[model samples]
Target: MDSPNTLAVRIEPMTVDDLPQVLEIERVAFPSPWSARAYEYELRYNDMAHYFVAWLDAWALRHPANDGVIGWLRRWVRPAPTVGAPLMVGYVGYWLMAGEAHVSTIAVRPEHRGHSYGELLLAHTLQDAARHGAHVATLEVRVSNTAAQQLYLKYGFDKVGMRKAYYSDNDEDALIMTTPPLNSGQYQEKLRRLQIALTMQLNTQMGRKLSLVSRTGA
Candidate 1:
């Protein structure tokens, strides 16, 4: 059985009120965090934007005095219902343009990186995109980000192309990837397999942590 602490994390949509918290996390997570004004614009001006936060009960479960966001994602929606809430433990963001879904960004807090939260967020985002009638999903990742590339490939996304100097930080090129057509049985099956693998991985990590805590207490 999972411990109460492991089950307490929640994935919720980003609201106007969440910007302060989101920006804080962004500052800690990204060297070039988006400005507060940028976040404000996203919340107020962009009708197609959907943001989310991942809330992890880090302190309450162990330390008792520390709590903070564990992950976040900002997605763009095109004429679809916005999903927002309990502040997610990770987030997936994308844009819909010209009948294709273009993933903008997906980030997990450093502490939460190995726990499958990214996978959860991606799954949720992909499901939502399908629900919103996207036929194809696309995204670009830094060439150096092999971990992210593997994750995308696991979901049936293929290396379709590349862009020169796509990321500004180090002028890193980006590898453009695209998923098979949405609602296709092959892609859905791959997604299902990936989800299952992610679930197992998360559960294993949670179990290990819980066991270590129990042993140390004993």
Candidate 2:
């Protein structure tokens, strides 16, 4: 944890308003990025789609502490009025339909990648998919992305197959991975334990003394 007072990072349903930040990350992280119009269509017209954004809490960015009377006024009289938008650090998207969930994409800003915010997003996605009656979840990651493969394996996803030339930009093969049935007790218990550890990591790294909101709005 860099600072004990750092605000919580939150994941919430992605809306049209989040496209700009989301696209910015996509462009930087991948050779080919989905366009804003594609994202808008997913948000507005794709009934099977589920997407989310992770943003930092707005408090400290808007009210960086002062050492004198103004700081005193903020602490004792009234909290400094929050200004500006909370930083959007990451996002994830997937599709759920007919008992299956397919992860479409996920990325964290390069600067924010090490803080476990990406793990937080992945955990939330699986849990949310299960709630919506998805029995299994799957995704395809570039064969070269060992870090991502390890992360997925940590959560019970197994490499089940391969997709030849799955990535359009470079014709890179993708490892197809799938989880055991999400509704099964074994899988659920594993996810529950992981969720606990993930929450602790997020709290430890991002600070969650307060302002941890519900999944929908966080």
Candidate 3:
């Protein structure tokens, strides 16, 4: 079961100042975490790279005077620099290429796992992609990540193919997954159900404790 603290977790957008924490989580989560230089390159060169973080927000009430910022998630429409104030908690990184939205990465902090943050992030990403004219979304997952595979399946992504020796660190094959055409009524119904499930899970985790305004104020 998810801890109450995890239920109260928040997502936010990544910022240049968040590199340290972001890299820390990356290092712990992946054997081949992208290097600081690579992240720098993404921030600089990539016309379409987004990054985000997720963290517990219990401190919000304890440190009310401090910034209420918590975790984040990031997604990019282009490789350009992110604009405006950052408000990410867990990010779904994807690329909109040739009319398809390709999810490149999704990660949550270890302490915040199994709380549906990833699903929330993906749902938000899909919505954004649809709004931006993407008709489909694709992603590749490590064969060993059964949990992630199940999550993707719950989101209506299906295994369409695979790539041999796709992961560099272990040379593991990757399972390529794709969603049904986004315009289909069936797909929309599935997405709606998933979104409802996600919201309910989040609310349950939070104990449906308070109004959004009160919670945010805390």
Off by over 4 Å in 1: 1-6, 58-89, 208-218
**Winner on lDDT (2 vs 3):** 2
TM-score of each: 0.75, 0.82, 0.73
Query: Runs in model 2 with CA error above 4 Å?
Result: 1-6, 59-84, 206-211
Best by the TM-score measure: 2
lDDT of 2 by residue, 33-135 (tens): 9999999999999999999888776554343343467667655754433554578878998998788999999999875577777887888899889888899
Best by lDDT: 2
List, residue by residue over 105-184, the lDDT tens digit for candidate 3.
78776644676767777776776666667799999999999999998888889999999999999999999999988767
User: After best superposition, candidate 3 residue 63: deviation in angstroms?
Assistant: 15
Candidate 3 residue-wise lDDT at 119: 77
| Candidate 1: RMSD to truth | 10.9
Q: In model 2, how large is the Cα lDDT of residue 207?
A: 43
- lDDT comparing candidate 1 with the true structure: 0.64
RMSD of candidates 1 onward, in order = 10.9, 7.0, 9.8
Could you tell me the lDDT of residue 65 within candidate 3?
Answer: 25
